[model samples]
Target: GAGVSQSPSNKVTEKGKDVELRCDPISGHTALYWYRQSLGQGLEFLIYFQGNSAPDKSGLPSDRFSAERTGGSVSTLTIQRTQQEDSAVYLCASSLAPGGNEKLFFGSGTQLSVL
Candidate 1:
């Protein structure tokens, strides 16, 4: 895809189950980010990967949430021992580089439902 693509648009899991969401960014983009939007809440940054630099994970809500980008292309977000509060729309975005001036291309997102 020319733009960012995320798989499994909708997911329903039990409270204690673990889930993995995938994101495929644009082919040449060097910067990728993961964010989540909860009901009535703004986008929350979860992680950011830029080139070969260490990822910035300061925005992750909890220890249960983790993400990794491989070969600077595909990224995966994993939630362990998911809770009801973890339900949200997981969004992926990519840019040519990481900076305030760069425009980000975002995926439609994965809607997670924890029952």
Candidate 2:
């Protein structure tokens, strides 16, 4: 089974442009989450979706950031207006549940570079 995978392993974008990063989670995973890791900083939660419940987008840095999970599997993160500060590793993870005890399987993120 595929653990998790991200596209464009590396991305270089101009400022004010938009980019879409894709993620394919493992089969049968019910919980999907997106997080950003800047330089040496810790992982920051962005958005999460579980089954048919409303997505938790509280962690999204701004309105420029949005995401959607389709068919309870693949997910995509889109940045409306890219900025230099937005350059970071956009990681996607999935788990059985959103519990602290459950280990999140992480995907090799899409490295976005805003020039």
Number of the top candidate by TM-score?
Answer: 1
lDDT of 2 by residue, 21-97 (tens): 99898888889899999988999999998953436889999999988888888888999889999999999998987
Cα deviation of 53, candidate 2, in Å: 4.3
Query: Any runs in candidate 2 off by more than 4 Å, and if so which?
Result: 52-54
What is the Å distance of residue 97 in model 2 from its true position? Answer: 2.5
**Deviation in Å, model 2, residue 106 alpha carbon:** 0.3
Write model 1 residue lDDT over 28-100, tens digit each, in one string.
9999999999978999988899964546999988999888877878888999999999999999999998989
Clashing pairs counted in every model: 0, 0
Query: Model 1: which ten-residue window has the lowest total lDDT?
Result: 46-55
Q: Name the best candidate (by lDDT).
A: 1
Evaluate candidate 2 by giving its C-alpha RMSD to the native, one decimal.
1.3
- TM for candidate 2 is 0.93
Q: For residue 56, what is the lDDT in candidate 2?
A: 88
Over all chains combined, what TM-score does candidate 1 have?
0.95
lDDT of each: 0.91, 0.89
lDDT of the structure predicted as candidate 1: 0.91
